[model samples]
Target: MTGVVRLATRGSELALWQTKWVVSLLPVPTEIVTVETEGDRDQERSLTEIGGQGVFVKEIQRHVLDRRATIAVHSAKDLPSTSVDGLVVGAWLPRANPFDAIVGCTLSELAPRARVGTSSLRRSAQLRALRPDVDIVSLRGNIRTRLTKGKGLDAIFVAAAALERLEIQPPVVEILDARVMMPQVGQGVVAVECRADDREMIQLLSALSDRETELSVLAERSFLRTFGTGCSLPIGAFAEMQDGTIMLSAMVAAPDGTRVLRGSLRGEDPEQLGGLLASDLVERGALALLSASEGKG
Candidate 1:
């Protein structure tokens, strides 16, 4: 806790902002070690074709495991549901806005057959559910590039938390309600991963962890783990605390947006609540929808 903590992160403006925010919260000196993962280099290919979001995370995690860095900071939602071997999410900062943001126009404001851009399957599926008449195009890049790309399209889907953290102002900023577009698991949370054997780093990072955020994400991740997937699957899970109780909500949708299953459960035990809700979805034929999407990919 007294010495400098070496933090590894992706080399993006949003990533740097998140890491710097973490650094500001720490007591000791912190140095950032920028690491570019596969996702950064292969900007044109689809995430599913290139091994999912894990492509953006693996290299960063390696730095911590190899001792090049003492810790790795990441957007919680980008992380895989299952914990990596020898690494643990030592801390989760307080949550941010979990709803997705639309730039250039609101969902309802868009004209029928209007072109919308997004790189995420979840976002596309939800948007299609709302506007089957619109055209969805593949859009991939950083915030600046996406904004630039949006100039060609009628609208774009982005994380509200990312825009809020960067204090960006778009021509049209509309925050989508989570009820209409379920958020990905661990959205709006920042998590730091440390080697399991490094008790010192664990203790140091643990001090910054917020219990409420940790529990909320725990339940969300539990749902994801039960479903056995990462971002590759068109599924979304979100959890929040309400009056000392946990409410877990999740959705499973076809990539084409033909079918969508939504469910929620309230309880004290985070893991149980997550599993129970997941089961509700499975019993309601979510498995079939997930299977069809997997086959298409």
Candidate 2:
């Protein structure tokens, strides 16, 4: 609190935008430390092949743990469900539009055998389930790069929040409803992490946290944590407050979109609601779907 707070973050355009927004809200001086992560190094490979869970965050987290940075900023969805041993999320920014958006063509407008581009297995699986006739192309890169690559494709799926944050508006954009496509856990949220022992830093960051967003992310992440650390299958969970209770909806699917399991639950405790929903889905054959997908991998 005495000196400038060094905020560690990825060098991506979206990442920087989110971090700067955080800086704007802080009452003290700040410095942005951009770190290129594993996921940034390999745009040619799929996330699962390049190590899915922590590829984008480990190095950025290392900066904080090693004292090179005071805090780490992350697009919450990029983080693994399990927390790092020495790190803790000090704050959760208010949620944005937590829904997938399609650019170039509407889902209903695409012709048979049309190609849909996406880098997320969750998006691919759901798209495949919805339109078996269309092709799910493997697309990768930053938002600008992806938009350039999607020129030849019939459509490309991206996060609605990403488009909003970057202020990029495609000629044709369609927001997919959560009921049609559940979002990834922690989607549309920005998380700030610091060392668990940094009591002063934690207290400073906590002042910027939004209670509703924290509870929603807590429930969604609890559901994801129930799936374990090595889960690479197509999984999606979304949580929101309804009256005084937390309502969570989740889905687990095969990579190929053959079998999908969906469940939901409401409770006053976020973690309990998430865990219960996950358990219900697992009991209804979510594990078998995970196994089949892993075996295929």
- Alpha-carbon lDDT of model 2: 0.89
TM-score of each: 0.97, 0.98
Please identify model 1 stretches exceeding 4 Å from their true place.
Answer: 1-3, 295-297
lDDT, candidate 2, 1-297, per-residue tens:
699899999999999999999999999999999999999999988888888888899999999999999999999999999899999999999999999899999988988999989878888888878887888888999998999999999999999999999999999999998888878899899999999999999999899999999999999999999987432568999988999788889999877887778888888888888889999998999888777666332
Off by over 4 Å in 2: 229-231, 295-297
In candidate 1, position 122 carries an lDDT of 87
Clashes of each: 0, 0
Native-to-model Cα distance after best TM-score fit, residue 98 in candidate 1, in Å = 0.8
lDDT of 1 by residue, 1-297 (tens): 566799999999999999999999888888999999999999998788888758789999999999999899999988988888999999999999998999998877899899999888888888888888989889998988999989999999889998999999997989988788888888899999999999988898889999999999999999988878887778998888999999888899988998889988899888888888999999999888888887343
Global local distance difference test of model 1: 0.89
